[model samples]
Target: MDDNLIFAVIGAGNTGQAMAGYLKLKGFAVRLYDRSEWRFKSLRKHSMRLSDEIVSSQKIDLLTTNLNEAVHGANFIIVSTSTTAHIEIAKRLSEILTNDQTILLHPGRTGGALIFKKILRENRPDLKITIGEFESSIFTTRVSATGSTVHYYGIKNGVHFSTLPAVDVRKIFQILKIYFLKLRPIRMCSTLL
Candidate 1:
């Protein structure tokens, strides 16, 4: 587990903020991005107040806008945005990302990874894409609305991830285990839908 792995978390909403805080605590360089202006503001305010506790001590870097800038050199990209924006975001990211990049879809619902794969294929057929999934995103985490801070109640119950063709599962899991030590790999079945 490399402590220097850079992580870009899209969608600075509740889930995004919670995960960012936790990842920072684990010593990963994390940057956050969101399309919503409100979310961006919230993240900034929270970061400012928790600067000593979350930023200064942990050295977590927070970025609200500029998707390309946040993700350009990141080793891992975590998509925590709503389902409606999933396709568009995936399409935009596919254009800029290289084949070696790893993408994790938090709270990957039915067909989420498949949809991303389809869009990537339509745009960059030659590029190999590998999208992973989790049992749930956030791990029962919550952020306080009053103080605009985060609270991680418990570790993730389980994180289930699978890559296309299944050959890249080990590599993906190895990277994930750094941040999520309790992650459990799910057996692949014919239906990813």
Candidate 2:
């Protein structure tokens, strides 16, 4: 796992779309996926409408409805769906994820990482995976009025994250810093102080 470039932006909503565009612009190979392939059709139409040309899916590596195909060989898997879908996605990912791959539950509001851990463990107890989470998504973006674009409202002032058990906090911080300008490191104890 390179852990530096290839990324899986699961759930191709506004955040996922924006992440796909932004990360691609930053030179990372990005794969976009949703349970429904129709979700990507709108992105193509919107890109064509805004650019007034053929929207080449080639701009990104692959966009598919297949979870296995989307997440294959990905170093970093960022789940961008609503929290309500966590368990289902967890179950799906458990069948595919490799231990070398790290799964980040962006905006892991309450027990998101653990929820995923439990579900994943149920499927494969022998698999040990690294997990990370941020209190919120690093990006603040939305779909345009015409639905042809993702309007990025700039990154938040500060984005802090933690890796469970704290062994790889530094590495997680290092990786996130490349994509998030406002990336901040937080001490788990400091959160309680």
Candidate 3:
């Protein structure tokens, strides 16, 4: 129910649509982005219909293939793309991301945050941003073959998340709790080689 937070979902797959629709359902402004325009051909008027556990038709604020347009002014950049795309996306994001923007990987898979953080540093060392990742996606969702509908499965509980610097966990957690009540903060160990 946060009225001020604007989210940019970076992907148009099942999870991305679910996250965007769910966030919009909760009364937040959301923009959906994808690299492929073909994926969006079936969507009508930039609206997504969610079925199953949660049912709602949400109109995304913006839908585009332009990464810069999607990232601009977004408070939270939610990366729902495949793990394999993380590196390249991180590289592109480093070019346009501004200070104080937070990036959250829906499911980092393995060492996703670390790799992304490293790439951002290498690409834009002075960029100040908080980057974090979940052990897995929060929602279990599936998009229909036509790409117009998303089957909303129940949210998974006990999802662990942590930020790169580990200093802003409390602040980020406060904002996240409104959306995900069951999220847990885990300390990212820097010493682990």
Candidate 4:
């Protein structure tokens, strides 16, 4: 990943923490966001410890409950929330997203990218962005009780994913693959959905 590439993980659950921690450890500037600030209270001094598959302790660049603040200037945004929350998040993002920003839903479930793009287009027709989703989460991880530690059971290999328009898959995958090496692009995303 380029040092200039900024990443934001929007969800403070297990996968979100692991991804944020892992990215921070890898030297990418990472901003972590959640709807609730209470979720971040357990993180010791804003630092997270990642163990198991990968081991590292690093301080995330930013932690905020403000969605706009979390994604401000972020080149890539990772929506790690539940599939059920996709529509709401998409509505919220329609208000905040800027042109050319890329969004990737971690394990978009089935038609996730399409649903998200539809919401974006419906809400903000002028917005120019790429939406994509993983068929499944890339991380098989869990967070410790204190919230200060993340146990990464494994990083999935050859994870399949696709973008809403399909054509942007290769371009987006090029940057994403630097962080998640096993990412594979599928030609037809709806077929999997």
Q: lDDT at 78 for candidate 3?
A: 96
> Evaluated with lDDT, which candidate comes out highest?
3
Off by over 4 Å in 1: 45-59, 190-193
Candidate number of the best TM-score: 3
**TM-score against truth, every candidate:** 0.85, 0.85, 0.95, 0.94
Tens digits of per-residue lDDT, candidate 3, 121-154, equal 8989998999988899899999998888889778
Instruction: Identify the superior model by TM-score, candidate 1 or candidate 4.
Output: 4
lDDT by residue for model 1 (8-119), tens? 9887766777677778877778988877666555455545233322433233496667889778888888898878888889888987887777788886756677888888
- Candidate 3 lDDT (Cα, 0 to 1): 0.88
lDDT of each: 0.72, 0.74, 0.88, 0.86
Candidate 4: segments with Cα more than 4 A from true spot: 44-46, 189-193
- Tell me the number of clashing residue pairs for each predicted model: 0, 1, 0, 0
- Two-way TM-score contest, 2 vs 4, winner: 4
Cand. 4 Cα-lDDT: 0.86
Candidate 1 residue pairs that clash: none
